[model samples]
Target: DFPPLLISLGDLRRGFVFHEVKQVLITDEDIFKRYRERRQRWVGEEEKKIERWTELRGGDYVVHIDHGIGKFSGIKTLKLQGRKCDYFQVNYKGTDRLYIPLDQLDRLHKYMGDSDHPPPIYSLEGGQWRLTKRRVRKAARDLASSLLRLYSIRKVIPGYHFSLDTDWQLEFEASFPYQETPDQLRATHEVKQDMENPSPMDRLVCGDAGYGKTEVAMRAAFKVVMDNKQVAMLVPTTILAEQHHRTFRERIAAYPIRIEMLSRFQGLKEQKDIVTSLKNGGVDIVIGTHRLIQKDIEFKDLGLVIIDEEQRFGVIQKKKLRELRSSVDVLTLSATPIPRSLYMSLMGVRSMSMIVTPPKERLNVETQVAEYNEE
Candidate 1:
């Protein structure tokens, strides 16, 4: 038998040792940094999928797998083992409070029980929450039937696996006049990640009117278009369609995407021509009113559908959209947050991203007061 030996052959301190042969190769800092960053992003995404739970605001109803329903009372810091740690505070029925450590958030979920209204707050005594959970779970089971059809379809149906964002996406997002809020950034990332995945995305982005919901949707739209896929944006009113068309055109000016609008403003012939272009794959993005859901409209390769103010759409239009929900990646935006009714309707069905934080900067409105004492 031969004895093992070690030898160093290169500048790098790290080496591979064999009986009499040893070699070391230095890693390039730039390449290694890029790879490390990429790996970090991938790991982050995977961690995100483990327990996808939304942030709970104070007073919002939530479910504790063991304790049933409660209202989030915010985080409180307490000294334990001579160290200060934050604990999640939840207020239950009848002056009962449950304090859960931050590490156990997975046990909690945003409560979505009973249609139109949540069950009355469960008291801590007499095991009332157990009964409430059973009743609510039953109601959820009944409502969940309508939602699972879409959920099942989404699981099997394969959507276009879009490529990652290009440099153009970064540039377009940078050109925005205002800074992107944290909620907006997360929502945009979720949208882009969904587009890159094989399964269809049916995410509902809920936010206030002045928040940056439009910006988030636009960023996703830009990503979809960058992948050479067409995008269709449905607005409730013609004025909004025009506004969005102009906004998209301006932000994506650097890209070669062709933007068009279809509303009452366009003549009947023009509408037909735009529809033709869409089917022939000439247009990259189209902004339109509710008429976009009409039977005559079609797309060549629509990868994404952005519906603004979804609550404004009528039952007929919603029915029309129901069919498309499974095939295409849909992003719905609204000024007001998703109501309990809508949430319950889609519960256990689709992913929802909310943007409750307001924008950082805005102009103030002047006000005047008059005294009518003499009148």
Candidate 2:
């Protein structure tokens, strides 16, 4: 094989004659390795830029670690103690201003709360910020203690260990229309492993909208059904529950599993019959909105509970979910998880799997904002 040839664009443009031609035997693999390393470094730098909260604009709300929330006026240069320095000007409630030194930027953070409802600016003289911070710290402590207690209880309680995959499970997976992505495969495997273990499975599967998170849940639900246990899928809205019901029925049409949907859209008698069927173990899978968690609804032998868009549920619904977590396996799916769920996953308090790879035919969604015009 001939070695690769190198030519400089500057040399070619200058109309210079080359004294000699040299060739080096560098493989394509080496060039690709260097390219990958540089790409990774660039990606890391971009992530760091995103993580930093230094891009503050005027009139934006900001929160200080020492003080409470305030409105960022602008940056100003002032002389203090016989020295000139730049400080951030923040306006609090009622004509109050606090100047923060540039060196102490770490204490400033951009407010990340709901934009529709802006937070009230705190007055520095009232000392109310201190009291608010104290209450927040106490709430955090209580949450941490409760989480620890739940973890300890789950560790000791005996949970059902599912058997290995059967022939029917393999066939069901093979029937999927599209090829599975690597991340999807890994997440499915981890979920199955968790179910097979003695501990009650509490795995969070996070993926983008079209990353096949539903497929992972389907596999888990099928596994539970194969073991002669029922599955309950909870969604936030009735529309989503109906959509999931259709998808699940279409996917498992070849199997003998009975899937039912419970939503407000159904007639009162229809809903009552579905509830009755669920209690008698006639339904293998039930998909519904918050109605499924009502006091009257009961399952024969629930093995797994799948929660979709968990952030949309209210506190009471989530409390009911927590109660279910103590007994049945819970699989949570979220495109954008809430801070609490993300925190638990990061701290290893709960098993988490991320499917970051998008499917082949998925397209990027273009978002546009337009002024409303009544016609």
Best by TM-score: 2
Q: Residue 181 CA error for candidate 1 (Å)?
A: 1.3
Query: Which TM-score value belongs to model 2?
Result: 0.77
Task: Provide the global lDDT of candidate 1 against the true structure.
Answer: 0.77
TM-score, each model? 0.57, 0.77
RMSD of each: 19.2, 16.7
**Model 2 lDDT per residue over 102-208, tens place:** 66665677787799999999998878997997797798797788777777888899788999999999999999999999999999999999999999999999999
Estimate, for each residue in 1-375, the C-alpha lDDT of model 1 and write its tens digit.
Answer: 424533323224222434454533344533355345423433332121215324667788877766767888998988866778878888988789888877777657776656677667666678876677579769768546745787688788788898877888788888898887899889898888888899998888887777788899888888888888889999889989988889888878877889999986789899989999999999999999877888888898999999888778776776677677878999988766346435643674567788888887755445689887886
lDDT of 1 at 166: 87
lDDT of each: 0.77, 0.86
What's the lDDT of the predicted structure labeled candidate 2? 0.86
Residue 229 CA error for candidate 2 (Å)? Answer: 1.0
Candidate 2: stretches off by over 4 Å: 1-54, 75-87, 101-103, 365-375
